[model samples]
Target: MTQDKHSRRRMLAMVGGALAMPSVLRAQATDPTVVGGTAEARRNISSFRTQRWEDHFDSLGVATLLADTQSRALHYWSADGSDYRLYPTSVPMSEELTKRGYTKVVRKRVGPDWTPTQNMLARDPSLKYMPPGPDNPLGTHALYLDWPAYLIHGTHDTRKIGRRSSSGCIGLYNEKIAELYELAPVGTQVRLI
Candidate 1:
């Protein structure tokens, strides 16, 4: 009798799962945002696929940084092609706030400060300047791009790393930015797409 009960319970569980499978498949197909199985998994997800530098740039001058906003990942290649690193990043909150196309790292700074841009201030009058520290939005390191007010910088907030959370910058975790800062010299070619 015990064996029969156990067998029946197993059969019921299988039937229930089979009934739920269609809804699960439909959800996965219809929703682009649905990934993995949990909220934590979705928020932390960044698709890190292997990328060839030649596909993006003519040459790895100094180094190269390709920030793919769609995938929420940053790809790096060394000038000599000896090193490559992929980092999950926070992209601009919206496409209107994003700046695309080619640029280069024009400057590098440790302990970078934060000052709201005119547009930022216009949107939020409460915004003010912030000196470099734990609270600074730019975190520990910053690689200023050739475009005015654009940067590939670090963020103290780890939750922002794999989300669309930045104002207009590509943001890495502080530790990751520190490593990139060491490897990516000023003049590293950068592209945002």
Candidate 2:
């Protein structure tokens, strides 16, 4: 019985030591490269605004502007606002423009045109549509803003267009977003009110 207890104790001690080894090794791991890389990237992005739009205007011309209604903030970026780090609503237009490498061209107040049927479809994603186009819910074209899940686009529900009717999507005249789509590049800056 004593031998059996001793064997069990040894087994338990071995298991305990094995479990403790991982915690000790994890605590000792302090790689400067991993830590410094994140810090350097943040610093580089923060200093990005100082580079000036004039310095890189040729390459940094407006690529995309995002407007967020939830936060009531506008974010501009190159290649559909995809290249730069995200910013808060408090950042100034000039700073946002410089950071994203674009110049602010215009700020506008756009309204939505929503109807009962459209609301039903948006709320129920299961409803099938041919695809997003001129007649689609997405409208003729989509002008994405910084607002989460909101977009400015043409609507098939013309009657509801131009009124405060959308759940959040901006309802534009079918020809408007389409025409704007052609005039505005993939990265054009948008100012939202």
Q: Model 2: what TM-score? A: 0.35
Q: Which ten residues in a row have the lowest lDDT in candidate 2?
A: 40-49
What Cα-based lDDT does every candidate model obtain? 0.88, 0.45
TM-score per model over all chains: 0.80, 0.35
Q: Candidate 2: which stretches are off by over 4 Å?
A: 1-130, 133-135
RMSD of each: 6.7, 15.2
lDDT of 2 by residue, 99-158 (tens): 222234332222332233454576676765455443456555665555434455666666
Q: Counting only residues 3 or more apart in sequence or on different chains, how many pairs clash (N, Cα, C under 3 Å) in candidate 1?
A: 0
In angstroms, the error of model 2 at 39 is 45
Off by over 4 Å in 1: 1-12, 15-45
